[model samples]
Target: MAITCGLVVANIYYNQPLLAEIGRTFRLSESEVSLVATITQVGYTLGLLFVVPLGDKRERKSLILVLILAAALCMAGAASAPSFVILAAASLCIGIFSAVPQLLMPMAASLASDEERGRVVGKVMSGLLIGILLSRTISGYVGAHFGWRTMFWAGAAVMVLLTGILAQMLPRNQPNFQGSYGGLLKSLVTLTRDLPVLRRSALVGTCMFAGFSAFWTTLVFFLESDTYRYGSDVAGLFGLIGATGAFAASFAGKSADRKGPDFGINLGILLFVGAYVLLAFGGYYLVGLVVSVVILDVGQQMTHISNQARIFSLLPEARSRLNTVYMTAAFLGASLGSLSGAWAWTHFHWPGVCGVGLAFGGMAYLLNRFYGRTASVIAPAL
Candidate 1:
């Protein structure tokens, strides 16, 4: 399931390293090409709001397979797109269907015992994070050697293969919610209203992801600029360095299991701030960039894993809905970050991008530090 999660989630990120090539192909600017990444996250937010809730109302394995197949079709569209508009449209569709990992996470949570849930989620999340980081490496090399469109075709083929393998390997999970889809979505609001931690966690998640997205969305442009005079292939190698965060995801899960999740969350947010500080001051040097990306990615996975560990423990029956609320907010932040990162790069360059990351990280720190200070919200039994 973890491997499958990584493969499907990777489709959304494959375009990041290829943004420069795509812009060259379409004769567009950095800000204009950024719409591809932004719209993709917008589609993902929509899927998190609408599609992920269905996980509770539908058979889990079948839902994952269907979404994977849909993602494969969308990737094919992306590959064949002749114009920028068509490519953006296909990217939107790809984001919408690429909500497969959200479904898979809840399935893994449901199957595991409470005692081991954090470890289990960490293991699966390691794969997802690896997929996200490695997708850049793979796509960067593929886009440089072949054309950018070849990466999309490769993504499609991988999804098709994942669908076939998961069908035979995954266990069939019965639906927990018997109500209509409309009712299921409505309960998301109810869940938000009732769970204070979910709301706070969602907010923190939003800021953290916004910072994370801002860095990644603008990185290739920075690399391609006169300062580095590098190509996409070299830019992609950073993902390999960032893969150290995958280990952080696992370690964070264990930390949350031993210490409280609050400890992990705060530590993660601090790492986020420190990473931006390094990037702001040291980003001109390749070693500084390398070190900052490692810090950034590790912080991202730590916060993400810790947040999921806390949220999944909230309500056994509403894991999907809880994830829906949280992930929807997170992806929405990502969309905003991508848009802002592009605009900042156009207006103020690398320092501006670093400023954006700092602002978001600081906001997240404030929220995490102050929330539940007076009183603690209790998590329900699994």
Candidate 2:
């Protein structure tokens, strides 16, 4: 499950360093290459809207398998795109189908004891975090040697194998409701009505990820600029630093399962704040780059797994729909991050990107404060 999710989620980020390579191949500008991120986020947001709810209504195993197959097809299309337009369209498809792992995650969660679920999830999520960070490195090496298209091909092959593994290993899932699909859409609106549960989970998850999205969106710009003077390969290696956080995920997971999310979140905040401090230094000193990645990634992944662990406890039966809302908010932050990161890169450089991340962190902190006062959060029943 970890390998499957890690490889699939990696698709979202693999193009970070390759943006420069893509610019040269397509005779595009820096801003244009940045659109690749925008397009994918937009598509993923749509996927969160339409596909994630399937876990609540449809059978999860089949839904996951179908989505994986579709993702494979999308990767193949991305690999074979004849032009940037086609490539962008293909990326959209990849984003749309990448919701597969989201489906699989809660399915895995449901099977485990609550006491151990966070640990199990954290271990699996470590794979995902590593995958997200490493894909950039892998793509850099692969794109430099074989061309950017080769990364998509590699992604496609991974999806093919994951599909088979999932099909064989996952439990059979029966439908949850035979109701109209329209009702599913209707419930989405209800979920957004700021129920105490959604308030605590969706809002917190979204706000936290906003900072995460902000930092990651312009990471390539940071590396490629005069600040770092890094090529794709070096930018990619920066991804390895993030793997440190991945190694720590199971620890965070065990902590979450034992102590609950509050402790994990506080730790996450301190770590993220430290990450920005490190990056602020990185803006001046080149060596700070390495430390920043490890700190930031560890913080982000810890908060993420912890947040999901808390939210899932609220609505066990509706895990998929809950994830849909959580992730939708998460992607909204990402979309804002991508667009803002591009504008910041065009205008204020590394400080601007850091500023974006810090602002989101501030917003998340405010919300966290509000959450602290709420009856739900004061003594969260979960």
Candidate 3:
């Protein structure tokens, strides 16, 4: 599950480290180059809404395998793209199929006991975060050395390997669901409208991802500017530094198990608020960049794990659908953040980008505080 999910999630980030190269190769301005990030994110959001929910209705194992295969084909197509439009289209396809990871998260939670679900989901998420955070470094280094096209090919190869592994190793899941196709869509609307579990979880998760997206999407631009000329290798190293978020995932997951997702999430929100303030100050210096990266990732991933723990606990029988809501919101924020960050980079440079991060962090902190108060009253009943 970990390997499978990792490969899927990595698709979103592999292009980040190579953004500068893509811009140069395609004769693009900063924001235009940013279209690479924005387009991929938009694709992922679409997949989250459409592709991920299929896991609730289908045999998850088969569904994941098929999506993995399709994503691999997309990556291969991206590698051979003859024009920017083709590349962007192929990126969207990759995002659409990468919904496999969303399925894997809920699957891990479902397979575990309620008390253990957070930790199990965290363990799975650790791999997903690692792939997300590290792919930039790997893609950056490799993209710098070999070319961006080769990075897609590499992703395709990994998809093939994971697909074979998933096919052979994953056990078949029993079918358990209610309603026809129309009813399924209706229930989705009902779930979105009535479920506090989905509402707060999706909103907070989205804000945290926005904070994460704002920083990372602009980071490479920072590195390439006059302040630093270290290029993609250095940009890649930040991904490794940011892997601290994976460790925080386990910590947050375990904390959610011990306390509850509500408390855990608030703590994460506070952490992000603090980290971004530090980033506001540190945005200019290299050492400050490293420090901010570590804290930022840890805070972001912690909130994410907490949100998953909360939402998955809400519906044991429909974890996949819940995940679809959570991730759809997250990817939407990410999509907006990528485009906004690019615009920030163009107009305000690092400071403008910092405003986006601060705003998102502030929004998350306020919303979670409000929700936490409500949750306190809800908890006595729980």
What's the C-alpha lDDT at position 156 in model 3? 94
- Show model 2 residue runs off by greater than 4 Å: 375-382
lDDT of 2 by residue, 1-382 (tens): 7887888888888877788888888999877888887788778888988988877788878888898899899989988988999999998988998876687678778888978988988878888888888888898888878888898899899989988888889788665645677887777666556356566656666766767776766777777777667778777777776788897788888999889887787688778878887787665675687778788888877778887787777667767777788888888778787888778878888788788778776676667656645554233221
Best by TM-score: 1
Could you tell me every candidate's TM-score relative to the true structure?
A: 0.98, 0.93, 0.96
lDDT of 1 by residue, 36-90 (tens): 9999999999999999999999998888888889999999999999999999999
**Which pairs in model 1 have colliding backbones?**
none
User: What are the Cα lDDT values of the candidates?
Assistant: 0.92, 0.79, 0.83
Please write out the lDDT profile of model 3 over residues 77-139, one tens digit for every residue.
Answer: 988988888889998888888888887887788789988988999999999999898898899
Evaluate model 3: give its lDDT.
0.83
- lDDT against true structure, model 1: 0.92
